[model samples]
Target: MSVDTATATAPASATTAERQDVAAPSDRARAWLVLLLAGAFEVGYALAVGGSEGFTVLSWSLVAVVFFLLTLYALSVALRTIDVGIGYAVWAGIGAVGAALLSPVVFDETLSAAKALWLAVIIAGVVWLKLADRPERPDDSDRAAHPAHP
Candidate 1:
């Protein structure tokens, strides 16, 4: 439900600074509009997953999967204008925490105080990673070249 997901990345050197021309306020507004749509989709997904039963649950899972991917897409679009670390931190932070809270509030799920504390610690770690803005990706060229990830 937290939609823990990753973004596809090319080598940092392969990234080029591209210029975008938005001549109209409508375009800017549309960006926010899509963001809202994506959030709405996530909430709907969480609700569906909570309510679903039987084979319907599988369908609901698929819906959640699509919603999660769409969320990543929206985050990518947002990151076009925002810092990658900031955008990633906010997206995952809000989704994970929001989902955890909704599980209890909307679905009558138990959120034991200990579990909540552990989740809080994980969120804090994410915040730290965001602040650090890791300068180098782990060396993974060999891993990428071979499926075994030696």
Candidate 2:
């Protein structure tokens, strides 16, 4: 007459091994790498869209579509392990910073010093978010309490 909470909460097909694999450090690292790639693709997509001139340019439109698909796939993969909010904010920050920095070279756009300063702020925020996502390590107090037995 009693229900097993673990089984009740987990998906029917999920095994202990599967859960462990999901939490593996390597998997988390790979997810973050994939997220960075996704952000790169987002920059490409944004530039291509601008070059497309409202999709009038056939080549640029095609390029934009390809980058769009690539970015979406990579984002979904990363979100499997990363929190959606953190993953999305980092991805967007990368795209915005990249596009702003490259606009002059790519499209004869101007990047004023003021804009550059704001972009740096965004970059700093993204870096902080990434740092915040790191797994917590035991502090000195925790270490003192649980001394290693050698």
Candidate 3:
């Protein structure tokens, strides 16, 4: 039996909507992961810049540059799937919190009680934003009216 060339080369029959529905959760998860990575890189960049002493230190400046590029790339990758406002807020929040929390350990900086409290608030806000972005699932009542898989 000879296989039809057209059929052999054709793509999967899944519709665009079906594919998006199936992939949306995973894509969102991956985007958030990348955004977190970007935030980590941003924190590294911030710390390195501090250590660089206004770019006078070659090694620290180089490290800062590397982190800068990494954070930008990862942030862009994440923004492709996530809303720009939400992604940017989370990224900035993570970077700010990480850098502030680590400053005392990495440098001659101090974290006052007020500063710590505010950081906690920022952390809470970031968590809330992530929660808000969660996709709503259809309840069992709705499932009967609108089937999951058509």
Candidate 4:
């Protein structure tokens, strides 16, 4: 999950001065890994909240709020260099489609070739955006949101 793709369309007026400072690439990458962990932490939420008794849903709800904050922070890092529109589109699109498939696999929910095919198409779009856009990284003056991952 590279951030460059999410930061393509920074405001032109945003001079080097306005750029939110971030840590080094390795640090940024580490932060993102935490974000990823936060996401993985959410799988439990679905199981707990997807349809549970009363308090379980409330507990999962609070957990979900935390997950949302972490996810937003991670996206902000990615969007620094990546285009916001592309970044969000890919993020939400890929997430929704993947979750759809994952639910079936993990929870024994229904799945069909047709649904899988559509999800494949959507994921392909994500790959294509990554390839086509090639958003720039932060300038030397700017803080790095994520360290280089590969």
Best by lDDT: 3
TM-scores of all predicted structures? 0.46, 0.77, 0.76, 0.57
Ten contiguous residues minimizing lDDT sum, candidate 2:
4-13
Count steric clashes of candidate 4: 13
Prediction RMSDs, each to the true structure: 13.0, 7.6, 6.6, 9.6
Please write out the lDDT profile of model 2 over residues 1-150, one tens digit for every residue: 998533333243564333323345777788899999999999999999999999999999999999999999999888776777888999999999998998789998999999999999999999999888764556788668746411
What global local distance difference test value does model 4 have? 0.55
Model 2 steric clash pairs: none
Candidate maximizing TM-score = 2
**Residue pairs with clashing backbones, model 3:** none
- Single out the weakest 10-residue window by summed lDDT for candidate 1: 16-25
What TM-score does candidate 1 get on C-alpha atoms? Answer: 0.46
> For candidate 4, lDDT tens digit of each residue in 1-150?
655733433365664223323234454445434434433444444444453444466765676566556666666665554456666666676456656767876666887899889888887987786566442557655435444322
Which residue ranges in model 3 land beyond 4 Å of their true spot?
Answer: 1-23, 136-150
lDDT per residue, candidate 1, 55-136, as tens digits?
2678777777777677778866655543455545556655666678677877778898998997798679756754553223
Order of models, best lDDT first: 3, 2, 1, 4
What residue runs in model 1 are displaced by over 4 Å at the alpha carbon? 1-44, 54-70, 81-90, 134-150
**Which of the two candidates, 1 or 4, achieves a greater TM-score against the reference?**
4
Give the residue spans of candidate 4 off by over 4 A: 1-56, 135-150
Give per-candidate clash totals: 0, 0, 0, 13
In candidate 4 the C-alpha lDDT for residue 122 amounts to 85
Off-target runs (Cα >4 Å) in candidate 2 are: 1-22, 136-150
Per-residue lDDT of candidate 3, residues 1-150 (tens digit): 997532332134654333334445667798889999999999999999999999999999999999999999999888766667788999999999999999999999999999999999999999999988654566787678857433
Give me the overall lDDT of model 3: 0.84
